[model samples]
Target: MLSIPTFPETDHQIVRSLASYSDRELVSLHQLHPEQGKFFAALFCRYGAIVHSVVQHAVESQLQADYLFAIAWRQIFGELHRVKLAADPEATNWQNWLIDITGNTIAQIEVPPSAQIRYTLNTAPPPLWCYLERGLDLLPPLSRLIVVMTQSLKWKDRRISAYLQGEGQQIPPDSIPNYLIAGYQQLEAAVPQDIREIYQSGIGKQADALN
Candidate 1:
């Protein structure tokens, strides 16, 4: 059986300490303190990229994507209390639920014709890094975290294993590569083919610099 970890006493500490929490626990904390943005912020950090990616895929311009992303999150914040889960293993999946809300929000929003034309004529598609960002968001939480630590933070597998173990996740250093392989595969698959081509064709330095 998995043991429940105790949260820190203060809101700030709790916020910083939420990296190891499950989605259900985070939602429950939000429900308990709806007045506190910190709880919801944890959820946002965990899945905000996925929400942004969904909006980006739906719209043509970054302007439109940004507009819809804000609206989607506003709707999500207001409706979060409606999310309920049973105690059983087959209970509601919070990630799927959040995705559904994002999709619905985007569907309800009609992009302005003026903005569409303005962006179409003046602005190029967002940098390739944006798609890569979205691809990382599409990964499972642990996989995403490992990839970010390894690639962005330059942490080795042993260090990542130690960090996870400290956080009550028992993944060993040897198994870390499997997670990286799976994460890389999912990331490549999630990004658009054209974007991948552009990124791989020697513009990657510029793209990485954009981040």
Candidate 2:
């Protein structure tokens, strides 16, 4: 049988000490002292934002993100005892494991009503718009959401961020433009060859008009 570690009567110092523990050390400590809330809290405080960001990126509604966050943490705690150390003790497998869990959590959510509506409306878009939609679909979920909101809905980055924040996501305004650029790149790369020229022409015309 594995030996479980015991905590002292005063755990406050232990909690503080956990703050400086390496990720591997933390995992080992948690495995030994599964009953200690401070160890779990320390891990959560260290990686909660990352998990939240991943969930927010994949989900549109705050409610859904909140739900996913809770599920992710619960799963993390439940599985911590089973985590195996990598050959490299310094590797960030723990964080990666959390991100993978977050992705899985997002996958369990139903497609949002807005996304469904957008898909329905685009069923018979014009040829150029058809290609645009296909390209948008090739983007990662978060990037696709950002592109649709920015280009199709004509929402400003600040507004987009605000809307996401209202839904419980914490995406900063500055990050929206980066997501847009990534979405556009995915679109450019994935657009069909036959429609590529037309797409380029349309973008060139738009650029010329702005200049």
Candidate 3:
């Protein structure tokens, strides 16, 4: 029988303390102390969901998604020491780099025929959550960013506009809603008909329940 290793109590405390560190700081810590797994754990806890979302959108089956998710982490772990943060504290280069790595991993995978056929026939949706994620991926980058920030991150329009401006793109607050509307329109058109109907039905049910 094989034995699994467990983290020490002190490592747990280290992970907890590292949660206050920013993404760049966490990456720096991991690079500086490659033996300390807690720093990497903290970084994964912070950004793993985003990575999972990307993998989910790229692959059809949960099994495939899970396999690719682990690969993504391995790739990130192998490459973290090479990452350089920008001088600007608010730069999103670290997050973008992780996303790029996941994209590259996805590109290397060959989708099985059965999954492709099922998707083509619109007989099955990948998963409830994946419908929206796939749709989000189909949108133009700026529109996708706005929608993800608004929907997934629960950021307000003003905040999104401010963040974009800080990143050097000056999107007005009043225009955010229009971008969101356009994003959903693009999403609806990009997804399969059955998936779109299912998503719309869920939204309808939620609205009905709220009334």
Candidate 4:
């Protein structure tokens, strides 16, 4: 039996739903509350690379994509209500508002005439396998699943909590990072390659080789 996910509505529909809220509710929720910023950040953290992909696809160079992605998030937090929001208010359409800003920013900004294109290997190196292993061991057995989901699979904190909760673990929001951090430490402590004894010093050396 295939279980289909139930999305409340499409992203565009979300925007429209949000748009339909009373102006007072929107103003209070978005403008007047300090906690609103935290909620917005949670959304960003949850949807990071996906939202980033939107920027990448909309722009030209990787650097430009990075820059615009950053600016979009910044604008979301800083410029809340500063610009006219979409009349449609669909989250998908609302995203287009940010996309338009990126396009417009590029149109106006000019640098001295230059023509060069270059690609570089990704600068962020993969985390050491040893460190990751150590990190995993640090977590209590029950907590390991959520920790892996967050750190490795890029699942968000709430999703991880839900997963564990479903499995009868009853994880609290505050403890998610603790599991991941401990797992990271375990991986960091992997036995050094050279010092790893395959033939065994704790046991007697192989008889024929020594003879």
Output the number of the lDDT-best candidate: 1
Alpha carbon lDDT of residue 80, candidate 2?
75
TM-scores, all models, native as reference: 0.46, 0.43, 0.46, 0.30
lDDT of 1 by residue, 1-211 (tens): 2111122222344345787877887788778864344556567656766777787777765656655665676678768877886545467588788999999987888877434332320111232344456566778999788877876666899999999999999999999999887877777676655444433433222222222
lDDT of 3 by residue, 67-168 (tens): 566567667766788899886787759888999998987887664543422121021212323334445566799977886787556689999999999999
* Per-residue accuracy of model 2 over 1-211 as CA lDDT, tens digit each: 2111122212345445666777877788768864344556556656766776676665665544544555566667667778876748676587788787767767765545432333221121123333454455566888777776775677898999998899887999999888777766776566554344322344311211110
What does candidate 4's lDDT look like per residue over 59-169, in tens digits?
555555544454455445455545444454353344455556555545554422213311111211011122123334555675556545754466887788788888888
Candidate 4, which segments miss by more than 4 Å at Cα? 1-28, 43-51, 57-64, 83-93, 109-211
Query: Which stretches in model 1 have alpha-carbon errors above 4 Å?
Result: 1-14, 113-211
Cα deviation in Å at residue 144, candidate 3?
45
Q: Residue 106's C-alpha lDDT in candidate 1?
A: 79
